[model samples]
Target: MTKKVVYLHGFASSSQSEKAVLTSAFFARYYPHIDYAALDLPYAPDAALALIRQHIGQTTEVALIGSSLGGFLATCIAEQLGCRACLINPAVAPHKVLHQHLGRYYHPVLQQHYEVTAEHMSVLEQLMPMTLKQPQNYLLLLQSGDEVLDYRLALDYYQGASIKLSEGGDHSYVGFAAELETIANFCQLA
Candidate 1:
């Protein structure tokens, strides 16, 4: 059977992320039988989830690979869709983290400066249900030295899920390709 895989990137990231690009290439070459999609999410979580739900609703079996904020979004989607997910350096509490992001920043790709606001943070919080209902459906990948988020938060939040901890890597997980096999295995594609 052909497997469906969707990759969702973090905030300020896009479908063109190095990890997404490499993973797409790897699957294209080695697992030609599988289907893949890389999502470029909107700045808002609701819009992103809508797009994800639409795509997932079309497939009978699916696997999700999400990074950072995308990972938090992925977990919510997986719960609703009953699909499996691989979360890489996921943000466990994005609403709280956004406090530090309340300023304007330029997006290199979009060539625009965007401000993080309280409303945006509230929207994120509203989208996330208080508790993770289906922890068993997720595989958490954490790096001890993530500069952006506290890895311990994810470790504790997803304590029930399968976890892979790397000793010293940043939030981007410096070398994500090495985890492709683990991701595939977790998704039951390996």
Candidate 2:
């Protein structure tokens, strides 16, 4: 059976993120037969979860690829749905870290200032029951020089999962085409 891959972007990011776009294009060339879906999560975690659940419910074999906050969501969904996932620069402690961003902020692409509140932090905590679980089902891709998030936190959280830590790469981990192949291989797509 062909496995379906779902790509989820980070907070304030969309399906149009450079990684997402490049992933689509790369897969189109390397794994054209595999089905892929990229969702624009915006800032609605519950809505994104619902859409992901609906999509996964329709498939038997599936893989998820998520970046940053989306990685946190992907881990939640992977646990709930019993699927495998690839997490790239995932936010292991988003609730705590996001305390610095507790205010309304504008997204240039979305063209709106969205509210960031303690309630959202509560929701994030509720969504992430623990930092990590079922490590065997996960492949974590981390960069050591991520300026936004502390990569060591992810390393510690995903201790038992397969990990690839690259030096000098930022949070976005751009210009790593070979890393995509590694991720694909880990997801058993290669």
Candidate 3:
């Protein structure tokens, strides 16, 4: 069967992120048959999850790749959809992590602005998976030098899953290019 990969962007990020772009290019160059989509995720976690879930419903053999906040969302969706997920420095507890940004937020790269109200934080709290549902369905790529999130959180959270812990890389997942092929293989995009 043909495969699909849904890429979720980080908080305040869009489909224009470097990782999203690289993911798209990787599919275009090496796996033209795969249906690759990178979404311009909304600021509201509820809306973003709804949108991605909608896409998953229409796609074939759906798999997921989520970065940062996207990873958190992907985990929630993967739990619901029973699909595989690849998380890139994903948020462990976004409800707590995002509490700091519970106001106006802007994205310099996408030049977009949005708000994260207390209600949105509540949605995150409600949606985050309390316990591991499908541990075997996850593939984590963590960077120790992530300035945004503590890598150990993900390491501990996804201890039983397949994890790629890099020595030093920022939250942006520097050197993500090197792992594209491996990620593709893991997601069965190859």
lDDT of 2 by residue, 1-190 (tens): 4388999888778778899998888888899888888876656567678878887777758889999998998999888767788999998868888878788777666676777788888788888857455788888888888998999988888878998888878989856566788778867874
* Candidate 3 lDDT tens digits, 142-179: 99999999999998888778998899989999999888
Task: Give the TM-score (vs. native) of candidate 2.
Answer: 0.89
Model 1 bad stretches (over 4 Å): 103-115
lDDT: worst 10-residue window of model 3: 53-62
Arrange candidates by lDDT, descending: 3, 1, 2
lDDT over C-alpha atoms for residue 125 of model 3:
89
Give lDDT per model, in order. 0.84, 0.82, 0.87
List candidate 3 stretches off by more than 4 Å: 58-60, 106-112
Who is ahead in lDDT, 1 or 3? 3
TM-score of 1: 0.90
Using lDDT, give the best candidate's number.
Answer: 3
Task: For model 1, give the 10-residue run with minimal summed lDDT.
Answer: 105-114
TM-score, per-candidate, Cα-based: 0.90, 0.89, 0.93
